[model samples]
Target: MTELDRLASDFGNAETAIALTGAGISAPSGIPTFRGDDGVWKRFDEGQFTYGRFRSDPAGFWADRLELHREMFGGEFEPNAAHDALAALARDGHLDAILTQNTDGLHRDAAFVGDDSPADGITDAADATILELHGNARRVRCTDCGNRTEAEPIFDRAADGERPPTCDCGGVYKPDVVLFGEQLPGAVIQRARSLARESDVFLAIGSSLAVEPAASLPRLAASSGATVGIVNLESTPCDGVADVVCREDVTEVLPRLRDLAASG
Candidate 1:
């Protein structure tokens, strides 16, 4: 049997299955990976993205943030086939949840969480079964008061020269995403670890598996006796340890995997 056939059989037999995705999964949807050749890193200084930097120069931080907001959310980007496949698997009970490292908000869009209206030609996954390792860029949070709200309005304010928008409590509003050098949310990390430990099959999709803490999930699942699968265009650190490795386009592979899992 083929590798995909084996994956399908294993998926069919799995009692619990989970997927971990990264920027590569969203790249097909026109979201640029931050570390790629033409990525955001080229234009923006990485040192300025830290929480410390934001604290030191709030106005400057917001100045950069406004530019980033325009770059990331200014265009109409949508989830691709890979997102739909994962959503389909979840809808069909073949997958449990998706754990993602992307801050792009494409997964939520694919899952249809925010709107009564859908994007043109995009189908909503039946449920929003996704866990974000990095926080969503589409949402904003008050650094002091902890109030969370949609990011669009805040972006508009930023565009209108409200560099750093103030919350009702007069606290600074920042994107909900975890900044560089900031600790990942404790509860989110714990839940992700718990899911990895409990999974019967762990699919690592599009991630290079280089980032710490979140990158350790695949190893955690493998150590716990789960079948580990890695799917990426390039080699990942975990490829040697993965039971199944498919170096192919995520958009193509995910749909095939979904079909096989459903058929099996």
Candidate 2:
């Protein structure tokens, strides 16, 4: 059988599957991966453009990163097949959880039929419980008081026309994403660890296993005796360790898995 077919069959037999996704999964939908040739890390100077720099000059941080956020928001990107398929699997009860390293929030959006509505027939969209190891870009938080707020309310402010926004506590507001120098969210890390420990099958899709903490989740699952599968365009750090490694497009693999889950 083909690699996708094998994955589908194995996934069907598994009791609980957890998927971990990174930027490669989002690339087909127009998002860029970091550290790749055309990635953000290569394009920008990490010293001046990250959370550490923000700590030095809040104004400059707002000036540089806010515009990037606004541009991304205005871009015509949508959830690609891979993202939709993952949500479909979760909705159909094949996937126990989704652990994403992406800040794009596409996975969450795909799960919802509407903002107010739960997933169509799925029990609770919220319960599917996507743990974003990296923070989300769909919202903003104040660096000063840790206030989480809606991004829509202040999208214009993040754009060039006005002075930057501040928290209720009078500190600079920034996107909810974890910047280069910032650490991953502790709550998310805990949730991911729990899911990894409980999973029967762990699927690592579109990740190179290059980043820390997030890269460790698959290892946790594997070490805990879960069947580990990896699907990526390129070889990953975990390639030698994974039970099954498919060097293919995530868009192709995820849809097949979703289809298999539906049939089961």
Whole-model lDDT per candidate:
0.83, 0.75
Deviation (Å) of 90 in candidate 1: 0.1
Question: Candidate 2 lDDT, tens digit per residue, 1-264?
Answer: 766666677677778788988889988988866677888667655576687777787677777776566545557788999999988787777787888888777877788633322111112355376767777777777767777777766666756444467767887777777787887766667778888888888999998888887678888989998989998889888887688898878888788778966775
TM value for model 2: 0.88
Worst 10 residues of 2 by lDDT: 115-124
Error of 1 at 202 (Å): 0.4
Could you tell me how far off, in angstroms, the CA of residue 231 lies in candidate 1 after the best superposition?
0.6
lDDT winner:
1
Candidate 2 lDDT score at position 20:
89
Error of 1 at 142 (Å): 0.8
Q: For model 1, how does the per-residue alpha-carbon lDDT over 179-205 read when each residue is reduced to its tens digit?
A: 887888776788789989999999999
Off by over 4 Å in 2: 113-127, 152-155, 161-163
